[model samples]
Each structure stands twice: as C-alpha cells, then as structure tokens.
Target: MPQTSKIFYQLKPLLQYVPSIEPPEKRVPLQDKLFWTLGCLLVFLVASQTGLYGIRIGDKTPDPWYWFRAVLASNRGTLMELGISPVVTSSLVMQLLIGSRLLHVDYSNKEDSALYTSAQKLCAIVITVGEALAYVVSGKMF
Candidate 1:
C-alpha cells in the first residue's frame, strides 16, 4: 500500500458513513434504464437554465472565464455554472496520485476499491466548496 492509501485507510470509518446507493439486487430492464437516463438528462438541462436565486448578470460585465465556461459546459449565472468540474477534477487528481504511486488501490479488493471511490467523493466535495468560495471571494458571481 502507498502512503496516501494509508491515509485513506485511516478515513475508512468516516467514509463508510457517506451516503451511497446500493447495487441493485436484480438486473435492471433496458426500458427502466433508458427512462432513468432520460430523466436525469432532463433534470440536468433544466438545471443548466435555472439561474442562481440571488445572482444577476449585467450585460456589460466582462466574463474572464468565458472560454473556460464553454469548455466545462457551464452556463453563466446558472445552477450548472460549476457543471462537472469538481467531479472531473477529483478524478484527474486521483488518477495522478495513483499513477505517481502516491496512492495505492487494489481493484480486485472490494474494500480497497470502495475506499478509493469514497476518497474521490470526499475530494470532489472539498473541491466544490473551495471553487464556490473562490468564485464568491473573487467577485465573479456577484
């Protein structure tokens, strides 16, 4: 096990309490899967168009992150402004760590795999909060 894996192992007790969906006991039908996929897509589209409650974008305000927004599939002043950035960032970071041997994970071991996933979730949550704070503090969301 790598050094970072040891650190993650220490967090196992807390990570176990993180909410997760259990695997389905039976195979899901194709129609049901399609329905859920479309439902989630609809929700995402709606969220992308939903403006933040207290934010108002002025027409003349310059967007410093305009190019970044396009790349991240984010909409300005909307609920989906962050898009999938946090999740993607966390995944990339985890991959980098593992590739560098900073973290060790055994894919064949259920416990190690679960811990790895839980760590990624925790990382994503932290990144999301940090990014939100940065945006607010930089006066970009005002």
Candidate 2:
C-alpha cells in the first residue's frame, strides 16, 4: 500500500531540477557567517515593523489565532505577517509525519533526503497560498 507521502516520491524528476544555491567553494569563517546572520535578522525585524501596503488604520479584524503569531513568526499587518509561517507549517507537518512513522526518511540516501526537502518546499508553497486566500476571504486583509 502507498503511504500518504507517496505523491512526493513521484516528484523526483521535477525536484531534481529545482535550482539551489551552491555551497561556498571555500569554508566561510564563523565571524563572517555570524555577521551575515545578524544582518539578516536586523533586516527581518525592520520588515516586520513595516505594515502591508494596502492596510489602513483602525481596521481591526477578528484574530482567533493571535497566540500562534509568535510560533509562526508573523505580525498582524506587516510585510512579515506571513513571515516564514508557510515554511513552519509545512515543517511541522513533516515532523508529525516523521514522528508517526507515516513517512520514512532514509537520510543515508542523498536522493531520499533531497526528495523530503523538496516535498516540504512544495507543501509550504501550497500552504502559503491557502493561508493567504483564507485571510483575504475572512476580510482580515484587503
């Protein structure tokens, strides 16, 4: 019998073609990596402060899931409102699958690992779109 994640197995060909940033040819120094990491965090913080382009003041919408904001790393109406939420959601799902043994991960095999990561990416995109649509339909965001 096929597992629920069997569909991801079928995506091997397309996943292989997914472009990825190559690793640094030379090892990066810790200080340099730390500097870049901090810089990115600063940028993300600034972005989270910036509100959505179309949102207006005094437009309070019902938010039953406000508690999840911290976990999902998002703000109410900022550019980071959906920040990493999709990725986190998909990752959480994958973790559940792995923990339940519903999805077997053969980390020793390069192809299997690649497929797992690629499948997560695909799932994240879908979840992102779905969440965005739900928010819009709920009149939470215009």
Candidate 3:
C-alpha cells in the first residue's frame, strides 16, 4: 500500500458518518434517467426563485456579486445563493492538494478512491456552512 496523507487517516473515522447516495442496484433505463434529471432540474428552478424569508434587499446598496452570481447561476436573496460553489470549491481544493503532493491518494485503489471522495464531500459540507455563516455575520443578505 502506498503512503497516505495523515489528514486522510485522521478523517477516516468520520467518513462513515458523512451522508452519501447509494448507487442503484441495477442499471437505469435512459428514459428513467432523463425523467429524474428533468425532475431535479425543475426542483432546482423552483428553489432558485424561492427567496429567503426575512432577507431585506437594500436598493441603494450596489451588488458587488452581480457578475459573479451570473456565472454561478445563483439568485441573490434566494435559497440558491450559495449555488454550486461549495461543491466546485471543494473539488478544486482536493485536486490541488493531490496534485501538489500535499495529499497522496492512490486513485486506482478502491479504498483510497472512496476515502478521497468522502473527504471531498466533507470539505464541501464544511465550506457550505462556513459560507452561510459568513453571509449572515457580514450582513450580506441585507
């Protein structure tokens, strides 16, 4: 077995508690896949339009994230304000760590791969919560 990063070893105990979707027991048909995809898209669209309650938008305040929001498909003062940022950011961080040799991961090994994935998910969750807290603390939603 190749040498793994200490960080990965330390996180191993917590990985089991991370929520994950199980793979389908059988192969899904194309039509079913399409239906599910569209269903999720519809849900996301609806959620994007659902504004966060009690968020006061100041008219005179210039939107600093106008262009940033456009690129991320996020709606200001909405549930999707965080957008796909947490997932993207976590993936980038993990990739950079592995690429820089800061975190050694053997992708060919099943255990190693699984651990790396769980680590990414954990990172994403932490980032999402951190971002949400920052928004509230900084009064960015106002």
| Candidate achieving the largest lDDT | 1
Candidate 2's residue-wise lDDT over 36-134, tens digit each?
A: 999999999999888777886246767666788777788878878887889988999998988998887778877677788888887888898898889
lDDT of each: 0.87, 0.80, 0.86
The per-residue C-alpha lDDT of model 1 at residue 30 equals: 100
Residue-by-residue lDDT tens digits, candidate 1, 1-142: 6566797889888898767777999999999999999999999899988888787744557888889988888888888889889999999999999998888899988889988899899889899999999988998574
Name the regions of candidate 3 deviating beyond 4 angstroms.
1-3, 56-61
Report clash pairs, candidate 1: none
TM-score of each: 0.89, 0.77, 0.89
What is the C-alpha local distance difference test score of candidate 3? 0.86
lDDT of 1 at 80: 89
**Predicted structure 1: lDDT:** 0.87
Candidate 2 displacement at residue 63 in angstroms: 5.5
Weakest lDDT window of 10 consecutive positions for candidate 3: 54-63
Residue 12 Cα positional deviation in candidate 2, in Å, after optimal superposition = 2.2
Instruction: Kindly list the per-residue Cα lDDT of model 3 for residues 43-139, writing each as its tens digit.
Output: 9999888878886444557778889988888878888988989999999999998898888988788778888899999999999999999998998
Q: List clash counts for every candidate, in order.
A: 0, 0, 0
